[model samples]
Target: MPIQPGETIPSMKLTQGTPDGPRETSIDELFGGKTVVLFGVPGAFTPTCSARHLPGFVEHADALKAKGADVVACMAVNDAFVLDAWAKSQGVGDKIVMLADGAAELTKALGLELDLTARGLGVRCQRFALVAKDRKVAHIGVEAPGAFEVSRAEAVLGAL
Candidate 1:
């Protein structure tokens, strides 16, 4: 099963693309002592991910912060370079952090891995979002297969 409300975010190191370069960060470092809104995408540049999911978060980053979110992050199974480029393409700047779970380690740790090997995409993270307060889940929304309602930024903001 996936992570649920009240569960602690798994302790795992993941890469994130920064203007300086790729940096290794752990879940605790990202979520500890903060209210974090983290969203996972199947891939960095896929249709729904690029067109709606990430953009939605970017559009609402300020509102989310205003609502008490200390950090807004977007994670994908892609590498740091790809994620960095995607962040640039999306004009994300410093508004959102781009996390790279290249090997899906954190995804599996969260029990939110979606295997797409048959489709040739290998293993990927599911479309999901979670609100974590001080390293524990306050809310989590995992979308149904091919669906995009529950994990939208608007939905998460309402939860906050």
Candidate 2:
């Protein structure tokens, strides 16, 4: 089932790269004790993702923080290195957490995986965003295919 507003984030491992190497980050670890704004993209560096989705959050990170968001994170189906490079290219800096859902573990757990096999993109995630507080989803928005409405940063800000 798709995750809903009252549900806790799924217990699965996502990844992030540290100077040491890539490592696991549990869903609880990311949303366990804070108000987190988590957004997922189909892939890192894709046109829509790079040009609009991710940048929206980066530009509004401070605004979200001002509205009581403790963390603003962006996740994609790519590995940590690609996510990091995408962040750097967008000048993301420390404004957003670049999460790597390399295995599509978290996306599948949320029932949001999109299989783009015909396009050779393999399994990926749909564009979506949510607010989680102390591990439970408080609000969420999943975009329609090829649409960029409810999942954007402004949508989350209005909810906050």
Please report, in order, the local distance difference test score of every candidate based on alpha carbons.
Answer: 0.95, 0.89
Model 2, 17-89: lDDT tens digits are 5444567787778788899999999999899999999999999999999999999999899999888788879
Clashing residue pairs in candidate 2, if any? Answer: none
The regions of model 2 sitting more than 4 angstroms off are 18-21
Error of 1 at 117 (Å): 0.5
Model 1, 60-134: lDDT tens per residue?
A: 999999999999999999999899999999999999999999999999999999999999999999999999999
True lDDT of residue 11, candidate 2: 72
**Please, what is the TM-score per model?**
0.98, 0.95
* Model 1: ten consecutive residues of lowest lDDT: 19-28
